[model samples]
Target: MVMTIGLPTQQKTRNNQLYVEHLSDDIQDHVYQAILEGVYKMFQMFGGSLSEVLADPSKKGKLKDFLDWQIPRLRVQHADLLDVFQGVQFLPLDKHAFLRVQCFVNRLEGRFGEIR
Candidate 1:
């Protein structure tokens, strides 16, 4: 059995063909690609499971640097990264405000098809 994970461009391309039998059209959004790239880099540096990697003796120090430094820096650089993969919740707004935004989104969707 095999497992698949995403990563950044540089790491992903290093041995991309070996991982995929047939590639599809590349993802168009730069943000999504960047997120994938980040995941790839983590996998390369820490292996599969984040907890398992942190538990290893050799990886313990690197884990501290990653948790303390890299994560905060990444959050500053990519504010949406943590939120991107999370489940959605209702906006913190009154009913009227929520309806207004929903109405605007509906209009935009009418004009542009769908968001994606």
Candidate 2:
């Protein structure tokens, strides 16, 4: 039996972590494209309307709840991958987006009190 096309080979050892074994340059490119497509799909799935997600009091609070609860859990789940971006870098839009989300979280936390 052979595994191909979006299926990763599984190993019995090492707590069952799968690797993209023997990926050529083209297979690697395919993997990268798949990841980008998935990311955008997720954004669209979670973000119905940009204005609603980024604005509107109720909608904004939901997004803040998601970021607070989920992002830290994701960090725990995928720490190795996230380490690639461990360095601090300056970009206007990135900083703006962070500030917007942070401001929303700050407001929400102040309003609702801490998660504890």
Candidate 3:
């Protein structure tokens, strides 16, 4: 005999994609892309690889400093993204910091169309 199971309705209807997936095309193309580029530039300014920085807890403060510097500039032009950032605590590092940053980058890459 074969058995079948169904997911709960709430689980079945849940959206697993990042909030960026729900944004309008223009916002995703312009605003989200700008935010991703800004973050890429900030990673450049950090003078280290993303994995290196994220893996080392000692590097957290330096990463936070870069975010502090970058956020105000982004706020001027990408306030909507900033709001999402704040809502998501995107700039802060917690115990799950590595996963958080990785997931953020992955989502951006997925939405903006990855080069690799």
Candidate 4:
């Protein structure tokens, strides 16, 4: 099953448009920081940095499996922050999920210029 974390359908508008709610800059930054922290913790648990995992094919596959397993549990643990990642369409189980996840990580790396 493709598990998703999002707001209820009833909360969507009648038009059915994918309207992204605007968050204040401060709140957005806070959410970004929280996500980074969670992702970093995951990397630490895997005993490697993002760059290390990406460079090593074996580790990359392992990370994909690890993320697929962990994301749901993390969602439950961080339920209060679920809205920050609302509208995400990919579950780690999806066929192309790992590529999308890699792209997301690459974007983050670009934005921050380093994993530190």
Candidate 5:
């Protein structure tokens, strides 16, 4: 049976695991809004174009599963900065230390023509 707002969906399986379909369009939008902001975009992992995958219904499950597995893995790997909502802390370092990193970034940008 379908459930209303503020109630969990009920399942009939022995383990009582609720089987949910893909998120409704409204819920998906709200989630995207919460996670991303102006000029910032979600990172895409696979080589295929996001628009191409999203246009086909059959691709959605695989894409969703990949994201579900990858996001948490990324969060754990970058937990220090990922947990922060505001700007990250990279201040109060010695001048040379800061410049060293900056120089590396400058070299990368020179070679790659913008880091993203």
Candidate 6:
């Protein structure tokens, strides 16, 4: 009934419980934790392969932007308007812009490891 997503950190924080749960002892690499129960299951249900459209060359532009810094910043910024807005400056994306990012989400399934 819930959904979880990963947003890599530019700087580490001591306060996040998700980071604590996922980090291996060495700390150089860590898995991302999904707050959602069903998200990992749904991703596995998709056959564990890139979609035909995503593998095609024409989707490169969409993939590039999704891999870039802009998209994640926008997601974080969406959470708390005044706090996110305070002294922060970044390019913005409109509501319709997210239609293209699903491919990137699909690619994340085995990336940080599944929930179970």
Q: State each model's CA lDDT, in order.
A: 0.55, 0.51, 0.57, 0.60, 0.50, 0.41
Residue-by-residue lDDT tens digits, candidate 5, 5-95 = 2223333544666564433432333333334331123425352456767688788776677667655554332223224443456668798
Each model's TM-score? 0.29, 0.27, 0.38, 0.40, 0.29, 0.23
lDDT winner between candidates 2 and 5: 2
lDDT tens digits, residue span 57-103, model 4 = 78878777777776656544343455355436654466588777778
The positional error of residue 108 in candidate 6, measured at the CA in angstroms, is 39
lDDT for model 6, please. 0.41
lDDT of 3 by residue, 1-116 (tens): 11122222222333664332232333433445556666766676655766777789898788778767765676433346554344454455676987877888888888888534
Choose 4 or 6, whichever is better by TM-score: 4
In model 2, how many backbone clashes occur? Answer: 0
- Our tally of clashes for model 5 stands at 0
Query: C-alpha displacement of 21 in model 4, angstroms?
Result: 8.7
Candidate whose lDDT is highest: 4
Candidate 5 runs further than 4 Å off: 1-84
Those runs of model 6 whose alpha carbons end farther than 4 Å from true positions after fitting are 1-49, 70-116
Candidate 1 lDDT over 1-116, as tens digits, reads 12233433432344445342333333235444465466546756765556666568787666566556654455423435443544256659998998999899998988998674
Best by TM-score: 4
For model 6 the local lDDT of residue 28 reads 18
When summed lDDT is taken over every stretch of 10 residues in candidate 6, the lowest stretch is 28-37
From the highest lDDT down, the ranking of the candidates is 4, 3, 1, 2, 5, 6
Per-candidate clash tally: 4, 0, 0, 0, 0, 0
